[model samples]
Target: MSSSSKIRVIVVDDSALVRSLLAEIINRQPDMQCIGTANDPLVAREMIREMNPDVITLDVEMPRMDGIDFLGRLMRLRPMPVVMISTLTERGAEVTMRALELGAVDFVAKPRVGLASGLNELAAQIVDKIRVAAVAQVRRAPAASAGAIVHPHAGGAAAAAPVAASPLLGRLSTEKLVAIGASTGGTEAIREVLVHLPADAPAIVITQHMPPGFTTSFAARLNSLCQITVKEAVQGERILPGHAYIAPGGRQFALAKSGANYVAVVDDGPPVNRHKPSVEVLFKSVAAHVGRNAVGIMLTGMGADGAAAMREMKDAGSYNYVQDEASCIVFGMPREAIAHGAADEVLPLAQIAPALVARLRGAGDRVHHRI
Candidate 1:
């Protein structure tokens, strides 16, 4: 392939080892090439100006402008796809959540130990992200909501306080449930849906393609911005209404029944469609267990991880929503779901929450109209 045909990438990290390793991995891909490497944001700024790469792998901490500040500036001036390289630590996870809010396409958590081999082991994920980032939708970052409203000390705050919960939809059918799935640019998309849901919304089970350690912080970040409580799902817990359960990274979470009540079944199952906490696993479970009582939503993501199972959802009488291409960072999954005739509604990202609310309210009216 011609040089111009390859995806151009810039590696930015404080550690020389990380920078070199990332560059090496990027170059090894036939479809991608690392054009430059920088030890800090100041150096990276110049590299970006001169090289104008398609994607950048950035570290969270740096000497001259930190990655967050650099990312904030970059997103405003010349919004471009960025894949963050974060350490697998609590602090690292917190900063990564902030980076995603700031418009990063995705992140790769570098192992805390054995940097070289760890990065090699993750090389497949690293290059795959670069491939996705090259085509991801990267708009300017929304202005900082934390700095203006709340102090930015610790525990990454939301862009702003959540809007008040919508009026309670009283006594939803005991069987009603919501199943959602996403990947690639899922963090923000998931947040957009969860924050707009009413506090009394039907029980929500979510599968956002994220690895171990990150989902904990991701759930916390969403919980801070959402009216409904959000937490990582645990094994065998009876799922409750008015809360959202996120499948833990490295585990599979599926909908099941415990007599009359719904429950979450988390397991150490192998990756389905190359993902644990796979959307297919969750959607298939919801299809068989919840059937017509469930609402399946396929949000912005890359590839067709759950398209077939989502069709199974529709065949089982579940109503489904797939995010439209224009509003998605990568339309692969939603497009595939729609192609499979799974989506009952194909809507933009911004309109999805409102549509879901309206659908639920309408369904409630139909169920209780005689009263």
Candidate 2:
């Protein structure tokens, strides 16, 4: 890409130190340039008008006006991609989740203490998120209903009840499981798929790149809107049908079999592909345990984290699908999966859930629907 094609970015944070650090890192990227910096949303508003950058990195907690409120207005009006800078604290996690719901593309967590040391260690992450944001779809978020609203500040747990699992649907010899992975624009993409699943859909396991304290609220938000139960995976819990288990942030979530029943195993492990609760880890586990019985879907994300494991799943006889490039916010992962010859089908975002449903239904015409 040419210099004229470099991604333009703006940094907005209350801390002068943070703003300078972010600008330095962004400017260092060959494909990106920090066009401006702001100490608060007030200044950011004006800078956005002047700079019209491709991406914005906003701090969650800031003086004058918070990032969440600014994000809401920005999405409704200008509709630009944004990556949130947040503290790695309980309160920070709660607010960051709210920002995602407000249409922020992604977020980075900073340490509350040792801000300088922590931010230094996160240089690569900071730049990578900005890069992803630059290409992410920046659409206005749907208005939140009272029922879908989650009061994360009040507590970390989601404010919804789990739906009762429906009796086993098909009579296959082995139980069916659905495993999905996503990053970047995943929060909304996952919601789009989950909302369309029926109450009797097969069990689902998801690994969405998110920080701890945010996954619970994400699951809760889905639980409120979807017909099926959505919750953070708990150690040793049975993977019941009609329920979706989201891999909890900051932990490795894998699947294991307890006799004929599949179960979730949440463990501590080093980050594979530079991510804890990595999509690669989850998909590989599903391949190892569920094999041909599982349905593997890799959605839009910024990297090739799950592509190899998706190949493994295919080798093990599981059906696989990759989100098509045209529908992806960032096509890296899905493109990698397709390149690996892992995908049995490549479908647009609107078609993935229904196609999966059709396959599981044993629709005789599914062969005609393959793209």
Best by TM-score: 1
Candidate 1 residues 1-371, lDDT tens each? 88999999999999999988998998888899999999999999999999999999899999978899999889868889999999999999999988887788999999989999999999999998998999987776545554443212112343344446654456774678999999988888888788778788899999999989999999998888677889999998989878899999999989888898999999999999999979999999999999999999999899999999999999999999999988788889999999999999999776788888888888788767856
What are the lDDT figures for the candidates, one per model?
0.87, 0.83
RMSD (Cα, Å) of model 2: 6.0
User: Which tens-of-lDDT digit does each residue in 227-341 have in candidate 2?
Assistant: 8899999999999888999999999999988998998899999999988889999999999998988899998888899999999999999999889887777788999999999
Q: How many clashing pairs in candidate 1?
A: 0
For each candidate, what TM-score against the reference?
Answer: 0.94, 0.85
Global CA lDDT computed for model 1: 0.87
Q: Enumerate clash totals for all models, in the order shown.
A: 0, 0
What's the lDDT for residue 312 in model 2? 97
